[model samples]
Target: MLDIAKLAGKIPGISHHFQQEMTASSQRLELAKTILQQAQNQQEALIERYQTWRDRLIFSAAMPVEPLDTRITIVPPPHRHSVFATDGSQIAPSHHEIAYCYLINVGRVMLHYGQNLHPLLDSLPEVYYRPEDLYVSRQWGIRTEEWLGYRRSVLEAQCLADMACGWVNPPGAHHEPNLAMVDGSLVYWFLDGLAHDARDLILVPIQEAWEQLKAARIPLMGYLSASRSVEGVNFLRLHNCTFDTPNCIMNCVDVEEQQIPCKVIEPLRDTTLWGENLQPGQRGPLWQSSARILELYDEAQRIYFCYVNVGTEIARIEVPGWVAEDQDLFNQGLGIMLAQVNKGFGYPVALAESHNQAVIRGGDRIRFFALLEQQMIRAGLQNVGTSYKEARKRGSIA
Candidate 1:
């Protein structure tokens, strides 16, 4: 149990600290906005400088695909369109349980508006108990949870691709403007930490799914709400630097004062900077990511992102290079996304429904362990039991 009285006594101090932080944040935001406006005024010079200093940049910034200040209004979606989404939930392998296994449940949803209003909702559950399935590389000290997460992401992408392909190449020959969406980033930056073989094991399947979607001409996007991404802000820092030739490693430290000039606007995020400029239902300029992992991805599957105002908050929408390069597909994809958010009231309806389908509640987890123990006992394994710590958690004594 929590000590409410003790926590309440610290509230005043916490509030004071929060107020001080907010004041500093506001001042930094103003400075960042001023720099943004200046960049807009001298866009050409900054672009040229970025081209010259691209190789020396140490920060993970975004490469601009359009004018820095460009804002495109999201047009209304077509009367008859479909949105397909997939989300996943997992039960991580627990040592306290009777079995050393994990389960992944992927929820798939397809919502149709206008002419056809049929909505499809389903989930696919898979259990991994084999030693080979549970480990990426035990010698490399990789955790099973990390491997599970990557596997789940790959499954979600493949599921979305299969659904989109079915919609595009329907047996009945019915087609409509459709958009495919996933919950998070399309870029697998986390894979950079893994060994080469393990990373390739995950990337190959994801790339194949992307290829399937591209071949089917289906537009796909990943939506992130309340994004705190700093890609654009870091780009601004490069522009704000005072050095004739930027070298963050050696030259910045060699300065007598040891103070980096571009660090002034380092506290800002892309969402905060764009929120002040973009109106409701408008999207800021698209920017390609400079993540190192993209070098391994196919050229067509490289990720690009844009900040969009979905009325409630600024969201980051990510798409593959192919979708971003096609004007009609890009417009259609954004339109469908906006319409979905309006229907769900600030969230995408298909994603929300898919989450509902995928969620595994506490009661479900308890029952799953119970069933596993029962099956084990029925199979002549009478020693099946939970760990002492798990048993103690279930029954506490005063």
Candidate 2:
């Protein structure tokens, strides 16, 4: 004992290091507990349940679980300082007799401040839904062909991504996008791509690009512009705030009235994300959704409603507007065989769905246009033609 004591006295640094270790251990334990609790608070059990089903069942609906959603309007950046905007579009999709062109417009805005770059909206692709060659589906049920339609949508969206990236840094450009804020999530944000082919999911390329961005420490973000899409029709799976009605009712934990603060972040560092409720997708851990809304104006006028079979999972289904013979809202009692068309580098969600699932059996363009005219009148707008025409440049107005 005497010899041990004498030896210990000689090693003063070891004693100090031991004391520091004990202190660190105590502090780390507390931190670990708090972190675990916070994670639990945000844990999504519904997502887990869905995952479990995916693993256990062989005959499940295998519905695409696109966790990312477009539930709100993107609040455009306040300034555009030398930013490069990017967009995408589908040239055309075959349908009935008329040609349907789908456009996805991308805009990227970058500002250089010293060595650091400030991105306004980097590769923010907004969908300008339209048609290429479409025919009425009332002759046949579109529901049966939903999977094929959805697959096409996924591919089209990916094409849009490619188009958007084409502008990120031109072949010989010296500069990179200061920030990249896409209109949709990293990729296939609205696509349940895994349902079709996991490797083919648009997420593959999107993920690769995103990783490159992260490694380069380039700030990249995505904005969910609208609350209703093919996948978003079913909004019950979300763990965060959701609006049953796309208008004035915001279903948030704290704020319950109107307006969901909005943010289109290029996550250089932690920041805010606000908009409508987002749907789910393949990018789980890396992608995050922050609570932010732009303003509380004009929410009462918007409404989104879609129907799906709650009992079973299924591949994505799209009831293209051109395929439906529903009464056109632009005119009354007239059948609307209308299809949205857009310029190259535009959005073609062409996967447009109606809220009420209006029957198109006896629908016509004249009556359908009439209803659309009424809707336009109620909204105090003269014509969507001008708006749509103006959108031809931006690729979208939604």
- Candidate lDDT (C-alpha), each: 0.87, 0.29
Write down the TM-score of every candidate: 0.95, 0.27
State the RMSD for candidate 1: 1.7
* lDDT value, residue 278 of candidate 2: 22
Alpha-carbon RMSD to native, per candidate = 1.7, 25.9
Show model 2 residue runs off by greater than 4 Å.
1-177, 187-201, 211-216, 225-398
Please state the error at residue 241 of candidate 1 in Å. Answer: 0.9
TM-score of 1: 0.95
Residue-level lDDT tens digits of model 1 in 85-134: 99999999989899999999999998878865678899999899998898
Which lDDT value does model 2 have at 248? Answer: 21
